[model samples]
Target: MTADRSVLPRQCRGQAGMPHEAPHTAPPCCAGPDRENHSGKDSTGSDAGSDAEGQRNQAVFTPDGLTARAMGISCAAACNPACSDPELRRLLTASGISAWQTDRLREVLALAAEASPYYRQALQGVDPASISARGGLHRLPLLHADVLRRAPLSLLCTSQDDVARVVTLDTSGTSGRPKRLFFSEEDLNATVEFFSWGMLSVGHPGDTVLAVLPGERPASVGRLLGTALENAGMRSVAGNMGQGAPALARLAHTEKAAVIVGSASHVRHLALAWQQAGYDPGSIHTVLLCWDSVPPAVAGLIRRIFGCRVLVHWGMTETGLGGALGCGHQGLHLREADLLAEVIDPVTGTPLPDGQEGELVITTLRRRTMPLIRYRTGDLARLLAGACPCGSPLRRISPGRGRTGEGITLPDGGSLYPADLDNILLPLAGLHDFEACWQPWAGTPLQITLYPAPAAGTDRTLRQQAEKALADSPLPAALTRHGGTMFHVARTAPQAGFGKRRIRVIPQGTPPLNSGESYHEQLP
Candidate 1:
């Protein structure tokens, strides 16, 4: 399912650094001092190469173009350990870039601390010299969601005039509130370079990739990815998978795309649709799943239909396109150079050793507009030490469970995470979709609404399956079954606004379930 080069120039091989050389096209508005080195025979049958070369040289040598190029190079090097190691850092310092960046970071931090009400109060009386000397990120007060929600964009050092892009990101399904993130032109360029390098590890140049995520929106990750694909010499088509399975299937067939990238849920839906349409998905060589965990059953389905390799990646909207990528021979490798990641006790905020499960904290070195210093990410995971089978120096984050919240109180009073239920439900056959809700009643019962396949339509069989899945768990005594495909379980809760829902345990006091309120309405 690799790209066929019959339609392009025989010399136009996929990405750079390959065995063959493709004719190089100069990027717009930027040329280097060595413009003659970039000049070559024009692909078009005309004597325009000389004129273009002259223009490129003039454009590249301009003061603004040179500054942008320098900044871009510096950002790339800072995010690459191969170029930003201690030795290289010293070399860069000698070359004047290290001092320049240090001054910039200091200036920005001071400006943010002074103008930002959130940081001003959080960093009250803190010495800037101490922050620079000790690198004591942990000592700095953590910036939580509440602060971001209340703060203004002016809190950042950069002005709106200087801001090139603003990206809006929905919090992981864990939270109901959405957040807006901003990016400068420099920030966006760095993201593009990082994305291009990561994809290059798996995809060749000129690969026809189909993006099945939410489209035609002003999402920063999607826009950056499209630009990266173009830079790598690849062609991409964006499809709105949120439109549903039928739309996605039609787009895939008509596009003849070799690669697919989207959320795990959307991809699973597409696989089901393709199966129903009697089309073999084997034509796709690579599938990239983002945002959510890849359930084992969905993975099996995608592999069976596509007969190709499926790769899963992890990152947040604030973290840019990708923070971790699954390699050809490894599970998932964290891009350590882009951000310094640490796992710590969620309750105590103390650092933990490798293999210990804890909350994830990240310090981004590449981010500029709103530099996140030791940001607390709610994800629960463990960091494993050592080199990967793929030979990457970056660390690996183990597949993890979701966060805990308010739902049912267990006998032992331990909260249940959504991952606890996902692990049990995803592998079950005949189950298409499901939603879990907690209702406050005299004695809370767990409510599970399931959408079953037509073949497994019997209510009795599904009830039996549900009972089996929760057999050993400490669910409440009363398991009430609804006649429809959906099963309702009663549970006590603090109420809708208390926070996230925990299905395992119920709170002591229970309230009555109102008939008008739907289960989805109770979701966080």
Candidate 2:
């Protein structure tokens, strides 16, 4: 049966006058298409209105639409202080454009040109006036991880006095060095607003949310998400998944949270623990999976265990929380107001047409502290042309294939990625935990360490499952079995510092690769 769209529980309404509170159930002040007011037109040609009453009513009355409406109001209230003016929403709705984009781009460019030595040197001979007009990111040089680590953090352009917070992001620990990013007061506020709005697309206001991300101190994403939830009248609790699943289960039960957000691996760990304790997370309304890809099999298992909707998202540390998120239609909708995303040929760096697969590149339009222009993400994906059915004007990126910078080069000229190996092994039933390591000889050899499911009760059964998974692959035949685990060696392994584990593809006689080396040195 279709859920009713007009009924609202009293608790969901929250305190009056709060922007994050659910819209009042009262009738809308203006009458127009879809019972919404026509104050102006949005970029997609949708009508905007001064009907605060109408928006409030829609937030509580429509089950499917309420969450999204509440989220929008919350974001509008938070970001309006820094990135947008109070009239910004009305202007966007009426004019069909976000004024923040124009204003932010101007501010960021001015900041970069004035304060950033790196940008000043890189942009030499390039006219500032014509920079915006130039299309395609390949025109700009790629910002490698090493450059970011060695450069002064102040090169990000924001004044140290205006900076409100600092966040250090470690990319899988494979880099061995983490990069620290600075956030301005405006940047933090804008991020909170964006996340508040995005969360509403899938969840209702005042719904409790549980977070299971890394770090004792909240990550940048976590802090903004928590603020957004509070602004929307929702209570949130940050749980440490590293402390193990039992701890997370206790928090979820105590908090009675409606949604859980974290990596799929972390969530799966908690789910297995909950199952062991004979507790089912049926009370959860949704699960927002981030960081890593969620396999189809795992998605089903999570849904079955939690009895909640599962949503996946994609983004990077440099972009704040502004990234693409999947809607009910299973299509990823990019936040076009904040970023311009593109896919290009990995080898030639030429832009690829829509629907063609290539490396993903991103340019931040809203970021003021660090405006990443044509940053090569090293992720493989394709851009989808045309509008989404959800009525958003944002761009979309198809599901990515493998890690951009790290992959094993096979003898036959084929490539293998840790992501590819994860996809292949994660779905198998008897598998518990596994790590892939690459050792190089004449060619790279892949060594996989398998952790069998405890329920299997026998090492022999686990070994069979492991061998079956590697049988058809181009791995060597001498698969070794140790305890309950099995190791399979392949002809090509990942490069040093690429895999999450200590997997080295450097030839036997070659020296170990260091973090100080550039991408060119490794590739050549």
Going through the candidates in order, what is the number of backbone clashes in each? 20, 11
Best by TM-score: 2
lDDT string for model 2 (319-352, tens) is 7765777653334666666666778888888888
Per-residue alpha-carbon lDDT of model 1 for 119-198, expressed as tens digits?
66767777655553114556666655544555536346556776666665454343544566666766666666656555
Question: What value of lDDT does candidate 1 attain over all alpha carbons?
Answer: 0.53
lDDT against the true structure, per candidate, is: 0.53, 0.55
Which has the greatest lDDT? 2
TM-score of each: 0.69, 0.72
Instruction: After the best TM-score superposition of candidate 2, give how far the Cα of residue 406 lies from its true spot, in angstroms.
Output: 2.1
Model 2 misplacement above 4 A? 1-23, 26-107, 128-138, 170-177, 442-444, 453-456, 469-524
